[model samples]
Target chain A: MRVVYDGTFEGFLTIVYELYYQKLKPTVIEKSALSYSLFDEVDTLVTDETKALKVLQGLQKWWSRKNLQTILNTFMCDSKSFEMDLLKFIRLGFKDEKELQNINHTSVFAIRNLEKEFFRHYHRMTGFVRFQELEDETLYAKIEGKFNTLYYLGEHFSKRFNNQKFIIHDIERGLAFVHNQESKGIHQVADFDEPIYSSKEEKFLKLWKTFFKSVAIESRTNPKLQQSFVPLIYRTYMSEFG
Target chain B: MKKDIYTKMQILSDSAKYDVSCSSSGSDNNYKTGELGATENSGICHTFTADGRCVSLLKVLLTNYCIYDCAYCMNRVGNDIPRAAFSPKELADITINFYKRNYIEGLFLSSGIIYSEDHTMELILKTLRLLRHEHKFNGYIHVKLIPGSDAKLIDEVVKLASRVSSNIELPSNKSLKLLAPNKTKEKVLQPLKLARDISLERTDKVIGMSTQLIVGATPESDRDILQLSSALYDKALLKRVYYSAYIPVNNHKNLPALVNKPPLLREHRLYQADWLLRFYGFNWSEIVNEANPNLDEELDPKTFWALNNLHLFPIEINQASKEELIRIPGIGVRGAYKIIAARRFKRLGFDDLKKLRVSLKRARYFITCRGKYQNEVALYPEKIRYALLEPAKPKQPTLFDINYSATTGEL
Candidate 1:
């Protein structure tokens, strides 16, 4: 049997809720928008918050807090067949709840690997994300991330830049994290206009570029080493690379 | 005037890059006072430059003008290079501005001795005063304590900065006399010892003290370097001892003339040994003794040691303690912990070790899973050494290589 659900994480949890109640053994799972193939028996699961909540509560009861967080982070990954992979993990998780903690398990290992990849990108963005000073003294930065990491980045920036107002726009994802002093908001930005830089911003950037150039030792200029640390894709928005 | 900052920054940062200590870790001071930034214990690398070096701290010299002429230094008084100095206000402004833009984690402020050691230290202290007291900037600030500076100035500098270091340029006293005439081993150790005492006495604001050693510049062996590092760590509570492979920056009759490139591989080997000293519970004698002063270029220090002492190998993976596991070449500090935690549930095989992040190919020859050897390779020291020395493939960056580069400020 094939199960189709909305792409949201809530939709995935509703499928987990159906596994216990409706006795639906799904052979394949696909997101609703991409579910075009005809199936002999098809179950399209509508996302119900109550059903999702029950599934989450059951996970907390049987699994662990870390496991729940791992699944949530895994859902945020942009890998192909990630939804189907999540379904496999959820099924195996409820089958033998204790097996969820075992790193040797194929499903648990796959989800944890996704979590590690997501967190690595998230942490790298935290350091690589540079803000340009706007004309109104607000800081504006944009990132094109592989995962939906803007959710984790907001807390880090808010705590660090408490006195400042800033907006971190995820260009590819079309989401922006707008942070003001003491309050933060995440909005879906349809179109973000080019930012106006402060007069001092350009000079600081020039000085930064100079500093970056000077700090590298000419005797040990290894491009391959540099590329390994700061991957080629991340240089697009980094001012130092320019 | 605005362009002057860039020009001066070029000279200052270029002169500063030779000192290979750009870590912003070891201290965990969160932004408690509504300051603009916070410091993580694991540290953060803002960016990596073309040299693959981490751009963590805004490593810069306050001034390239000096009174003493160190033979190995680019900014020595005798050298005919362009010299520049940043005023206290200019440096403090630059550090704060850079921090605001997330260009750096903190400021690593070092300077050449001008007029006197005390005078240079006072200028650095003033910059720290402005950042800490005036701007209330509570981010990571690593300052260089002038070797022969007054104790009062050292105390003041230590109180303001989050981390401090006094570069013991060359390892031995003979090398110090031959290269740096004005500085001595006692002068360098005095400040490091004082800073350690002061940091221990202070109840608030934890401070970490570190020092740098110029490797391959002098006639000091790896044993000599590691012994010095071990002493500094044990006696003065030095948090880190950085080793920079000598890059011939200036022509000097006293310095070692290198025809080839810098001793980066040798420097890398020293770092591996240094890691064993700090974390792996191995002493200087264990790493490199009087018989073998230099590390083998082919194998890593741990692998070399494992090969030298093959009698202890073929230990059961499940039965080995955490200490025994770490001594293995492939299992790092993290991998050792992972193995210890996972083996409690069931007996782990060679495949299980791979999942736990062990370097199975390297560990396979030494370790056995439940008394069953996974590989057909012999365990004899000569055969194992030759097997490891056989160049099978091009070197790819492993986790150990990344870990060493990150810890030792290598690209």
Candidate 2:
């Protein structure tokens, strides 16, 4: 049997709940739905909030809150085999009746590595988000990150820019995290036209570019080392790079 | 020079680029709702420069004019470089704008001795006052303390800025006399010492204090530099000791000739040993003795120490304590904890250790799996030393200034 979830923790937990309750063995668990599969019985799970919460509380009994966050980080890695990996990890945790992450198990190790990979990208995005001021004084930025990191960055940025109005669009995913000081929401933005910047925006951009270029020591110029710290993909939206 | 903000920023930032303390990690200043900025505990690097240095803050000098002719300084009074100064208003404006756009975490303000030490310091104070009170910018600010500034001024600096540092570029008083006749070891450390005492007395959030030591500049050994740092940490005067490879910017007869490149590899090795001192629970005397005053360029300090004391090694991986575990090569503080945690579930064999991400390459020679050595290299010190030699890395010829030397005042 195949299980399709809604690409969320709650959805994945609902599938886990049904897997235990119905005693169904799933060969493939994924976020995408297949079109008209003849051989395999495909089950699409509607995210049941009660079942998801129950599963979460069950996991909490065996693991600390920090370990639970690690599991969420593993899911956020968005790896091809993350669903199966997390499933095996959850099973191992219940069977062992202890924290499986510290157990030196293969499945646990794989989940931990994926968690590290996800945090690495998320941390880089926190540094590289370059916001330009729009005409109405709203800070605007666009990102095309590798994973669904939009969910994790909202709280960090909201706390940092608490009083400012800003819109950060995950351009590749067609989603925008809009914050207007008091209220914030993640909306599916189908048509985000090129924005008109504030009058002082150009002047500050020019000054920043000048400071960036001049700060590099001539004798210590190494493009290779610079490239290693910041890869080409993250530099796409950075104003100082070009 | 009658310069625009653009021209002044370029010159001032270029002048201040040599001050290689780019860390913004120490302070997490609480942010009010309508405040201009907030601080991250693990400070964000907005961008990496072409030199591969972290551009965390808008590092710039308040002014580049000087009256003293320090032999190693690029902005010495005698040098014919273009001079510029940012008025208090201009600097505060730039910091606010940059923080507003998320281009920088905050400002790193340094200046030369313009007119006098107090005069230059007061100019820096003016800028910080505007940034703190006028603009309410609560981001992480790292201001360079001019060595001989007044105690009152230092208190004001601690109040406004999130982090402060005074560069003791010359490692010793003898070297100070040779290169910078105006500066002494006492003068350089006075403000840092006073600031620490005041922070403790007032029970305020004692900000991070740091100093820079220019490696391969004078005839100071790694032992000498680390001893000074260890003493500073003992007195609680310094949270960090930055090792900048001596970039020969000036040509004085007393200083090293300008032909040699900055000791990048030696600087890199010192940084490795600095970690051992601060985090790995190694002392300066253990790291280097009178027999070997300098760090070995070929092997890291930890490997060198392990080779020197072969009797301690081949520590049982499963049974060794945390201190003994960190002594083995290729196993860091985190790796040691992983070993301790994983071994509780089962006895960790070589394959199981590999699963835990421990490199058995350098570690195999130093560690044994339940009294059974993994490698057949015979566990001889000289033979293991020959086998464990790191392949020399090709020099990048660029500044890879990553300092992991800060500890309590955490990493």
Candidate 3:
């Protein structure tokens, strides 16, 4: 049987609810946007807030809060098979008492690896996001990350630039995490035009670029090693690379 | 040359790059409600330079002008290089601006002494006061304390910065006198001890002290370096002891030739031995003794020790204590803890050990899981050593192998 739902995390929990209530084993768990085979029986699961919360509460009893968050972050991997993989992990989590903590299990290991990759990308974005001081005296940064990691990056930058207003725009996802002093929220911005940097901002960027270039030792020049640490893709957003 | 701020930054950062103590860890201060920055316990590397070194902090010198002509230093007084200095306001502004952009975790401010040690240190203190008070920036700041500076300056700077260091440039006292005539061993150690004492008394933001020692420049042995490091950790409560391989940045008859490589392998071995001394509870005497004065470059210190003392091998994994488990070559501190915790459920086998990420390729001869030997053959010390030294797998065959395989199908 094929199960389809919206792409949000709540949609995933709705599928888990159907798994227990309907007593069914889904052969394919996919988003509603994906096309299914004609021979397979398709069931589109609607996201019910109450049902999703109930399933989350049930999983909390057996698994840890960190484990539950890991499952949710693993769902954000954007791979084709990530949904079914997370479903298999949650089903295993519901079994014998200590099964969830067992790292030897393949399903558990798959979700753990997904969480690792997601956080790896998230942490890189925290460093790569370079904010420019706009003409209005606000800080702005734009990133094109591989995953939907703007929310996590937002929490880090918000706590840091608490007194100043800043905007972290995820160009690929068309979302911006805008924090104005004490108030912060995510807004959907369809297009972000070229930001205006004050003359002082441009000068600081030049100084930073100069420092980055000069700090490298001339004797031990290895581009391969540098690329291994900060890949070429992340450099596009960094001010030093510019 | 009339250098602008950008050119001055280029000169100062290039001068500061050789000091390889870029770590920003050991601070767990989160962002205050109205603060502009925060620090993580594990530290964050924003980028890596072309030399494969982490660029965690904005490592720069306040000036590249110096009075002391240290033979190994690039900014020595005798060198005919362009000199530049940053005003107190300039550095504080740069640090706050960079911290906002997430370009760095903090500022690692070191400076070449222009006139006197006290004068340079007071300039550094003025910059720190500007950052902490005027800017209200609460980020991690690691400043280097100038040796021979007054104790009052050291106390004030320690309270302002999150961490401080007084680099003992050379390991031995004789080397310090030979290469650095202006600096003595006592001058360096006095500030380090003062910082440690002041930090121990305070319960607030200050976190101990750290120091750096340059290797391969002097005739001091690795044994001497480790002995100094062990004492610093024991007596001074130093947070870290950085070992920088002596890169030939200048030419002097007293220093090594420019043709010689910068003893990078020896530097790496010293770091591994340092890790063992700090976390593995190893003493300097155990790692390097009076008889064996140098660490083995071919093998790590732990493995060499394990090979020398084979009578302690084949430690029972199920029954061994955590300390014994760590002494084994393959099990790290984390792996030892995992084994102790997991063994409470059931006796672990070889497969279970592999799941915990134990290095069984090296551990097989030394450890036995549940009394079942990984290698059933009679273990000879020389044979096991040779087998371990052999390459894990043969290098990928060249074009000749394809020709040989095509002709020798034997169909």
Candidate 4:
């Protein structure tokens, strides 16, 4: 038997809700698999916010706040064998309150490692995501992230860049997080126009460039060390590098 | 008549780069009252410069004018360099603009002593006040505390700045006397001790002071440096001590020649030892003492210690306590905790450890999986040391050598 739902984490939780109430014993769970055995039964469910909420509330009762948060964060990671492993992890957690402490368990161990990688991705992009002033004074930044961290950045920057109108577009996924200090939205777009620069934008950029250049000690120049910090993968989006 | 921001930034930051305390971690001072920028406790490094240093803060001096000529300093009063000073308004303006565009995490304001220590500190305070009160910018502000400045001024600085440090440049008292006549041990330690006491009095959980120690500038051994650091941490409640391998910036008779390059690996070793002191539950006496004055350049401080004390090794992976687990080579603080947590659920073996991504190259020799030693290498310390030795690389450090980052056993 196969189980399927929308790719969102909440969708996965909605499936988790079915797994308990409906007594599902799925051989496989996925956002959508291209193929399933013809004889295999397929159970498809749309994402239900209420069902997800119930699953979350049930988890809160069983698990510590930290473990529950880890569950959500690990789910953010789209690892291979992800859906089945998460299902096993959740099942084990349900069986024992101390399951996450059992880091030797394969499913628990995998989720824990993915949690680290997920946070590393989230933190790096949040730090490296550089904002520029647009003509009308909207702070705009872009990131070509390997993870779906655009949503995370929205919450972070909205608090960090208080009262500032801003938009952070992940051009790779054609997704943008727009915040107006009071409200926030994540929108998908096919294309985005290059923003017009503010009058002082050029001057500030030049000053930043000068600071970057002058701060580096000439004798201590280590391109490889610099490479480790600002890797090739992130250079395209960052203004300091090419 | 006014110098542009670019010229001031270049000159000021170039002078400021030598004091190498780039960390903007801990202390939740930012974002409580700021409309412009927030210093997330986990600070951001927007970029890394060519020297491979983190560009987290706008690390710059307010002015290069100095009343004291410290021999190791580039901004020494004797050096005939281009001089400029930022009006408090100018520095604050530059900081806000760069911060808005997310070029930096916050401002690291350092300055050369001019007129008096009070005058220099007041200028820094003016800049901080403008950012924190006027602009409502509550980002991470790391200010340099003037040694002989007024107690009231230092107290005000402690309250305002997120973190503070007074650089003790050279390691020993004699070296300070030889190189920097204007500075004394009490001159540096007094302000740091005051800041620590002030922060302690206000918030019991607070750690607000650090100092930078210069390596290779003088003949002070690693033992001397680590001893100083350990004492500062224990006695004065010093939070951190940054060791900058002496990169000769000035041509004073007292200082080393420019030809002797920055002791990059030695500095790397000191940092490794410092990490052991702070996190790995190791003491200075245990890591370095009378017998071994310098850290072994070939092996890391931990590996060196492990080799020296082979009797303690072969700690059972499944059964060892947290203290025993951390002492084993290659198992960092995090790795040790991971082992402790995992062993309750399952008896961890070589396979389980491998799956957890623990660095077992050196660890396999010292640790046993279910009382079974994992490595083919003999239990004898000499044999294990030879087996563990990484194939030697050239001594001459380059601009891009990536080997300097030996994990100071992950925090």
Which candidate comes out best when scored by lDDT?
2
**Per-residue accuracy of model 1 over B237-351 as CA lDDT, tens digit each:** 6888888888888899998776477778888898898899889999888889889998987789999998888889877879998889888888888778767767766788987
Tens-place lDDT per residue, model 2, B1-411, is 489889999999999999888888867647888767789888888898887888999999999998888899999998999899999999999888888788998899999899888998899999999988888878888989998888899898887778889999989999999999999999998888877877877775566899998888799888898898888877777878998888877888988876456677788888898888788888889998999999997788899999999988789999999999998888999899889989887888888888778877788888888678865687787898888774657656558654322210111
Model 2: residue B133 alpha-carbon error in angstroms? 0.9
Q: For this target, which candidate reaches the highest DockQ against the unseen true structure?
A: 1
Candidate 4 scores a C-alpha RMSD against the true structure in Å of 3.9
Q: Quality of candidate 1's docking, in CAPRI categories?
A: medium
Q: What digit string (tens of lDDT, one per residue) describes model 3 on residues B1-411?
A: 678898889889999999888888888757888867888777789888877788989999999899998998999999998889989899999999888878898999999997889999999999999988888888889999998899999999988887889889899889988899988999888887888778778874346578889989988899999999999888745889999888888899888766455677788889999999999988888889888899987677888788878888889999999888998886789778777866776788999877766678778878888888866544666766776787657667786543211111111
User: Once model 4 is optimally superposed onto the true structure by TM-score, how far is the C-alpha of residue B363 displaced, in angstroms?
Assistant: 1.2
Model 1: per-residue Cα lDDT over A141-219, one tens digit each:
8898778898899878777777778899989888999988667889999885797889999788988999999898887
Clash totals for all models, in order?
Answer: 0, 0, 0, 1
**Winner by TM-score between candidate 4 and candidate 3:** 3
- In terms of TM-score, how similar is model 2 to the real structure? 0.92
Candidate lDDT (C-alpha), each: 0.83, 0.85, 0.83, 0.84
lDDT (tens digit, per residue) of candidate 4 on B205-245: 65567889988989999999999999988885678999987
Per-prediction DockQ, in order? 0.56, 0.53, 0.48, 0.55
User: Which candidate number would show the highest TM-score if scored against the true structure?
Assistant: 1
State every prediction's TM-score relative to the real structure.
Answer: 0.93, 0.92, 0.91, 0.90
TM-score of 4: 0.90
Candidate 3 versus the native: TM-score?
Answer: 0.91
Error of 4 at A11 (Å): 5.5
